[model samples]
Target: MMFEKIANKIGKYTVLLISLLIALILYPALEQYKIGHICLTLWSLITMVAIVVSLNENKKTSKRIQLASGVLFLLIGTLLTRQVLGLSQEFLYHLILPFSFLFIAYIIWIILSSIFKRKSLGADELSGAIVSYLLLGIMWGLLYSYIEFISLNSFSFAAAHDIQAKGSALFYYSFVTLTTLGYGDILPISRFARMAAYLEAVTGVMYTAILVAGLVGHVGRHR
Candidate 1:
């Protein structure tokens, strides 16, 4: 009974938690292996599925299943093109980044709608808020990767690393910038890159402040 209750309580959060864990721990740990990119691709697909499932929680069962199926189809196509097709990484990035941006935008809209709705905060709403913040970091990381792909040497790494700005490195940089950490190990050198870095930093600060204020106001009204 206790296990069942715990499972029910965390059911809504399971996918989100798994996505976070894969990105933060699993991906990073396996990144040095030959299967790293494969894992990364799988991670992205899983994240997309999680977002679709979360957004469709209120829809009819049939409609939810249909939407999830569509998303899965699209993600599978992307994965095949990346892995099976003899396409350059740059070409793959060009193809995927636009769709990735669209997916992130849609989920952010849905999550923010849930967060700002005039209702008592619940586990769903709280998780949506947290996921939305992480999504922002991911969105910025994608942008950073895109910028670096188009223009080499856009970001300078202080450490003597053979790989340029890409993959997990850019994500780490994004979160660091988002938190305004400015670690200086990775520095954006180009004009646009600098602008993006600072913009993310500002957005991070503003988002935290606004989210806290909104949650507090909601709590006060409920009381």
Candidate 2:
């Protein structure tokens, strides 16, 4: 009974989480089109709506909604400034970084709150847990991009073509690091970049261990 109640409470997030996963997965292909940034902006708006709807039960719901609105507005404004006004892409990236960090932080907080409040596992709970892990990889990818923007040559790419260590490349690197796969296709040379990579690797291992242990315990109790 308790598990069902908790699961129902968090079930609202399932659709949103699935949407986020789809968006991330499609992002690389979307980049091939000229309207890719616009599509990404639209996805952000959709995700924001999902977040607001899912968190309607929270105490600061109004504030979170407003925050999401602000993020959308800023993202749109940034996109227009870059595309329409012919601003520097570098400047636009810098402007968007802080708000991006804030938005991702808010998401992580919400997911962690939902996960920790659960006394038992359910399908929704397991899905949320997995999404949270993916979110960590996305967050680190953004951080890696920011670092690359600030300090060029932080990472080396082993691709045949000359690839910039930003965007999908860094995102791929982030997930690889998070999983501790160490494919060696992308190498972090700078001190800070190396530090961030190792930290993500450690976090990935620890988080998986803890999640597995918790799931096992829950199963044992249920049995």
Candidate 3:
């Protein structure tokens, strides 16, 4: 049982860590990008295998956490590919908003998960539940950001440069998107991209809502 628990956490975190590094390698939007992309893909597959083994142990909290993280990680993995390519504002102009929202949401999710763990009731079960809830937020935030960024860049990079963007633009856009607050300075120029952005907004709202609901449920019912 203890061995299983340790493996489960290792698997989940491996997925998260590899995905983050892969994003960095892939977001440059430049040529000669194949190596990083392939390595990221391989790591993603390995993470999946680890998650599967961990889940097979079938502990309830582990199952739920793994399930949620697995699904989110898959999406996040796909999105991480974009991080390999978001290189210049010429390219970023198209993907700026999506990338921005994606990064911010991820940061929020990680921080929340960490805090949730720290607030434990001196019990493993409660702490795990809160951490799972937090991962749900993190997973959604990261997954949504990846989708948003790819959609924008793939569809709009050809419209020509609107000026170069710094790497920080992704974080800025991600924060706005994660908070569901859009200022309209950054617009999605294509139908799919627009819808992707909308979905991100919805996802953010739902994640926050779930976190609040989980907190309430834990307090009222778990106690």
Work out the TM-score per prediction.
0.81, 0.82, 0.43
Quote the lDDT for 65 in model 1.
Answer: 47
What does candidate 2's lDDT look like per residue over 116-187, in tens digits?
666776777777777778888888888888888888888888763222326678989999999999999999
Best by lDDT: 2
lDDT (10s digit) by residue, model 3, range 79-99: 555556643223432443344
Residue 70, model 1: lDDT of 73
Candidate 2 stretches greater than 4 Å from native: 1-10, 61-65, 84-87, 160-165, 217-223
lDDT of 2 at 208: 94
lDDT agreement with native, every candidate: 0.71, 0.74, 0.48
Q: Where does candidate 3 have its weakest 10-residue lDDT segment? A: 158-167
TM-score-wise, the better of 2 and 3 is 2
Model 1 per-residue lDDT at 51: 55
